[model samples]
Target: SSPLDPRYTFENFVEGASNRLALAAARQVADGSASGVKFNPLYIHSSVGQGKTHLLQALTHRLKAEHPEMRVLYLTAEHFMYRFVQSLQTQSALAFKEALRTIDLLVIDDMQFLHGKQIQQEFCHTVNTLIDGARQVIVAADRPPVELETMDERVRSRLSGGLLIEIGAPDAATRRSIIERRIALTAQHMPGFSVPDDVIDFIVRNVTTSGRDLEGAVTRLAGHNQLTGLTLSLTMAETTLKDLIRVTDTRRVKIEDIQRVVSKHYNVSKQDLLSSRRTRSIVWPRQIAMYLAKSLTLRSLPEIGRRFGGRDHTTVLHAVRKVEEMIGSDEALTQEIEVLKRMLEA
Candidate 1:
């Protein structure tokens, strides 16, 4: 049986600006437009804990519901390799290929796992066969196809050949909606349980990482609400989610630590950040590290710049001020930087 999670259906999915476009495209594919298999291999990319798995599983469930007669295969890249290897061990390699090729719809989650030479060839063959047969295919990964460094050019090109969609980090309003939906879902099992609007807003403002963190926040709040035998309030939320919300939870962050964290979170090389790669990718994360280095450390702008590629004090000061100004006005940027800060502190 397919490992599709029923809880991840479209009904339970809370649509927001961040995921609206991806959700719509997934819907169009799920409904099977007569215009033909237009968006073959719908590649959805996003950061970890963001709803890639949810959307992939939701599409599988919808396809199974709409067309029961269609043969649908939903599995991760690891599981696919497992099955393929099993078929070889069991002397059913040909049968395995036949089964994979004949499916009406094929969906693979975490496509980044299809990186090795042999595995990429096998998976690429399967995808090519399916696409040639007019069968719909969908894949999800943490980065875009072009950014998949481990994958070969042939497979990477094929993955990018399809419509690529990137799901951005959820904004504050989206986080609030997610919390509300999570609360409603929890109420189904824990009747008479609820979180106050203020608490939800507090969580929405504070827990700005991912949907998974939002789920954790609600779970903790509900548990606390039950223990206290009263509504969850702002005060309780502040105390209960203390570690989650507090950016200063850890000791003073070192300049080295800030650079490593910012580089990793932004998926850029640490040396690139220290180097003079003024490209948007390198510059943004460098500025973020500069900002964090200033805010979280007692070091001055000149000191921070000295640590970061021996840049001028004015550069570090500008970076700090820029991040501060963006955090105030840019809701999405604020959420992203907040998540990075929280991850670093934790």
Candidate 2:
């Protein structure tokens, strides 16, 4: 009956540089003992399923783990509004407000859902009560304070007044790690289940958008295995995950998105990128685009070659190799590609 998932504890939360700041801030909020305003309202902002909810739940879990009797509450913004509305209609608003004030740590998720003047008013009042009482409050939203223009100014200010932590888009390495972690979690349920590293790398290279997508891939693979009782292999991964391959935002990553992002990053025109020009400028960007297509999609070398203005498989192979070599030694190029990959995935 708890709002927090029992499994979302600090031990399971995988951290990388992108999310390190947010994780540290959440831990601080959870450990601070002052009854007065110490990181009064910890604001966490991240795109969907980037571990903001996980971090919030982890904070709650740690608090309760450390202090069994501590008063705590965790609810989505929708649930908070629902309770507030129900209490008003039932003439028990006083009880609702009193109960909220008693919680030592109040965690709210999906704060972007808080809208409407009445709901905003109630949320603001509740936040004010918590902050004024020096009780810790945490909120998660898809956007930061300035972008959430619909929210009350006072509430927005209060949220921004304290610490603002952002759970950024996870990089390729981090995404791969997350996929491995999810696979390990799956193994806990199915004793002998296992997935190969290359298969996991395939999923990582393709499902670049969010942690949820990685989890979904793991779930699908597990479900398929459970039904057929077949061990997982690259061939199985290729066939079974045909739909999940190269998808971001619950849909397939179009060749156009990758081309557009790469072209923009390298300052080349899309037409020139796909054209026959072998200029050093056009060559490398074009190669990168091809490399991304190969790694992120199921497109065959010939298909990819055909897409790049009748270029041969040999040319595409050369480009892919050059980029891979550069990625291995060229730190600047690697960073550039990482940014582009993140954009395409986003």
Candidate 3:
């Protein structure tokens, strides 16, 4: 069988202001010259489609190319949990320990899924073994250790001890570059066809967040054009991704729905969401929920504020603006918001 390809290597990754630091850090880790590199277990946290997995895979590929003898294994946290569970069920826990112990490098993706005490304990043991043996360990997740409510304290502390890096959403320029790069790749595969610059610009403008969604838009447009024997244009691209572009489609989401979903996800009482608690935990989720309600629903700022515990309309405006700035730069918060969005949509 052919080997699986890395999705977010240096070649395909679009460097931008949002992820420049993270990209540089990954490169440094790969080069083995990063100062105070005691944090061998580099933790990358980001929202889905923000290229966390891509960066992780890229790092692994680079390390393998530079150090082929390094035993590198890249799997999701779910896979880790599954394997650990299977080992116990099959009475082969020793084999699982030995297998993991022998690896020189381990990369686990989507580590937020690694919940439960037993799985976390096993992971802690594996992490300690790797660290004590001077092995490289990298983990990617949707949120930082401190915010992972389902994780055990010991596991969370261990993860926090390592170098924690957050990969934020791409900016406008980065989004444009990503569209261009994907269009180029599509052209290579489709030979006779090409995506116009105007269509690229339209995509970059409308798909204001999430590189994954942007790529999906490009791919969908290319596929639709090819299948229907039609030209790819800005209008057609918009029509193709109408669902994605219409963020304010009230039929799809409501202010009440946002409040409910956010409240449920964070396990915060509806009262707390309505309360003026200004605590980081409450304030962050409240702002995000307010932003979603205003952006996704046709609700007025006053209405959204009323839904979120009787804050003034200005407070809602501030919350939306704050979340907008945060979505551009804060990786962990972005992931949490994305998760809330998915739950609302689902």
Task: Report lDDT per candidate.
Answer: 0.82, 0.81, 0.80
Q: Which candidate leads in lDDT?
A: 1
Could you give candidate 2's per-residue lDDT for residues 236-320 as a string of tens digits? 8888777766455522345677888889888999999989887999888899999988876556677678878878988888888
Q: Which residue pairs in model 2 clash with each other?
A: none
Candidate 2, lDDT over the whole model: 0.81
Q: How would the candidate models be sorted by lDDT, starting from the highest?
A: 1, 2, 3
lDDT of 1 at 44: 93
Q: What is the TM-score of each candidate against the true structure?
A: 0.72, 0.69, 0.71
- TM for candidate 2 is 0.69
Give the per-residue Cα lDDT of candidate 2 at 121.
81
Worst 10 residues of 2 by lDDT: 245-254
Off by over 4 Å in 3: 1-3, 35-38, 247-346
lDDT of 1 by residue, 1-346 (tens): 3477779988888899999989998888778762336688788988666798998888778888888998888889888888888898999988988998998888889887764687778888998999988888889987788756568788899988888888876899899889999999999989988887788878888987678778888999889877878777798889889877643322235567888888888899989999988899889889989998877766667767778998999999888898899999999999998887777665
How well does candidate 2 score on lDDT at residue 240? 79
TM-score winner between 2 and 3, please give it. 3
